[model samples]
Target: MSMSVPVVGNFRQVPEVAQAGCRITERPENDLTDYAQLLDVIDVGICAVDRTLCIRSWNAFMAAHSGYGSREVIGRPLFELFPELPQDWLKERFDRVFDLGVPSFTSWEQRRYLFSFPHNCPINGGVESMQQDTRLLPIKDELGRVVQVLVCLFDVTDAVLLHHRLAETIQVLEEERQEQQQLIARLAETQEQLIQSEKLAAIGQLAAGVAHEINNPVGFVMSNFRSLEHYVEGAFTLIELFDRHIDVLPAEARAQVARLKQDMDYEFVANDVRALVAESRDGLERVKRIVSDLRDFSRVGETDWQWANVHACLDSTLNVVMNEIKYKAKVVKAYGDLPEIECMPFQLNQVFLNLLVNAAQSIRERGTITLRTRTEDDHVCIEIEDTGAGMTPEVMKRIFDPFYTTKPVGKGTGLGLSVTQSIIGRHQGSISVASTPGLGTTFTLQLPQRHTTAM
Candidate 1:
């Protein structure tokens, strides 16, 4: 019988005695060495099975890998000789080679260990079993009829282990990348908070000084206005007495007095004088109220929690930002009567100022800004709505992000909403907004009446 052998072309240490695919006839015993010697010398594990799946030939490489001698495995059924073999899978592979006359291949990635061969290479010395890359080849007879199949397996444990290690390395690098991004975000937020805190501190100092400096002048002006009002009343009474005595005067004197009174428009002057003095008094009172509001809003040294009137906070903030808003929008206040709640009034006042100023700036020319306050369950809700150029969803998403702004070059600092959010967070409050482009924007602030923790 002729044995099937693979062509070992130019293999190191292979003898050049037989050409590949050359079948040997049942010649003299000395002629067998021409084909048999090459198959026994190659390192690639080789085994042949006939149509009945009986082990027909087992080379030296197969004997070394499987630990079975050629004499023991030859002539036995391949599935019976190796009980651990995937019998059905191997049979299907064999059928394709024997029945269809086509070869098949299986990579190490698909099936790691095929024969459970013990590790032999120094590079894979630590591995408990060998990994293999296998191939099945058809063996045809002289009549071109397929009679047997040759199975070849190559050790590939080192390559598979290297691939696994590289994959694990990539996973670790991805995790590190995500962690670095998170750290950078935290650092940026901290830096923004520091800058905002310094700005607020400076403003607090300035507000305190300005309020003190203006308070004295406002106090004296109000006092002097009251005295002026009294003087105007006395002057009007004397003028009335003089008119009553005019009829008793000599005819010549009476005529002269009438001409003087007519020329002076005395009645009109008297009425207008009273109105002017009243207006002056009202103006002085407004100045005094503004100074008082400034003092209340800049109460910076008083950091401890205290009961605060919410209505007063809203009113004071309105006055503080009146110049910015009055020219842009009509302000409407719907204040709800509520009890005082514990909070840092100055910080809350800052929040109100930021929201009111932002609402005003949103308007291109003129709009209406409505401030509404109402008590909900355990909290107070302050809503500031403006009929201005509203925000798109893209802009609204990053509205409170540090250094983000929609305003023109020099008009906005971009820190208003960010600082407002920080202060509200410390107060354990929340702010939310809803808007539609070209329609308007509404910002709602919810504050707990009494926070259990200190800010």
Candidate 2:
């Protein structure tokens, strides 16, 4: 018969062995050690099937893992013991592996085929009750004809579960990092907006002071012009009478009356008449220019972009704040030749206004504020320097934070430098400051020469 004795010498110790292939070798001595004892052993299940898919070899590990004994599984169609598996499909692959001398496998797909637990295998029962990795390996006969199929199994549920858990944790951390970045960006923008609002508030307060200051000087100058107009009418009347009476007078009297008069008392009445007209006209013109500049500088959020003259904006802001600096500080300007830069004119005007005011305020008294500008290859450089009480490192570090004030509660909101930095950065430019506590401070702003976006 083709059936043969087990290869292991101590055969009785093993639960079962599958005779999947034709055994062709001559029998060895009974005293020789056999295959089962020579190999490591486990309690997990194993099985073998013939060409018709009937169970052949059933090992102790298979019996223990499957909770099925050899007696119940052997000689039975393998599918009858585990109906949960795709029986016909598994059978086809198994058949093909043997036919093609290839191997086949299955797992996870069928959790419970015979029993729920390996420990549940019947005593003489096999270990086929646990989670499994079943395979079909081809066996060849001496003539190379296919003979049987071998199947093996393992318990991998724990490993599969751990892999899934690790994947989930990684996903959670990445999501958190992204959220934090977005939050940081949002917080920075909000802080910048708040700083700008405070600066605008300070400007409003300064504007009130400016209005009060200008009104007094303006009222008198305007009155002076009005008075001078009436005086001109009187002077003209006197001249007409002199002209009419001139012909009757001799040549000597006419020459004296007609001679050109100097304002420094060459001819008193004529000089007084000329001086009043000239001074009043000049005063009115000066007042008109100052008012126009104030309006330009204070105009709010101009969204439209234009080729704007930054120099003109600076001139306007400086004029508006002239009264503030005039008494305490002297402004020294080193304006350079420049091209018209494109931007939101009114917004840039606000920037200039902030910078100039800061420069003026930096000085305690009787100091100099230097305003300078230059153009490099692709950028415009503006430097504002003041000889005033400069900053310490501690103050500079906290200067950009909102509401961090160094000035006493009313005089400063401490938002000016922060706002200046934000505006410059928004324009794709950079701003930096250098200071020495007792010497002075310099704020340098660098802007791109050409902007792609319309400000």
List lDDT for all candidates, in order. Answer: 0.81, 0.68
TM-score of every candidate relative to the true structure: 0.61, 0.48
Error of 2 at 428 (Å): 1.1
lDDT of 2 by residue, 1-455 (tens): 24332244333222222243323244344645443432226544556678888887676666655567777887998887877667667767887877787777666654433334543432322234444556566665546566776665666545444444666787898899899988997798677766667666577557556755786778787787778787888877887797778899888876765664333454676667678677767877778678666656545344566777778877877887888888878889999987887666666767777777777777887799998999988888888899999999998888776567777888876666666666676677888889999899988878776667643
**Deviation from native of the Cα of residue 16 in model 2, angstroms:** 55
Model 1 stretches with alpha carbons more than 4 Å out? 1-189, 250-265, 300-302
Cα RMSD for candidate 1?
8.5
Q: The CA-based lDDT of model 2 is what? A: 0.68
The lDDT leader among the candidates is 1
Please tell me which predicted candidate would have the highest TM-score against the true structure.
1
Tens-digit lDDT track of model 1 for 2-23: 4333443332221222122223
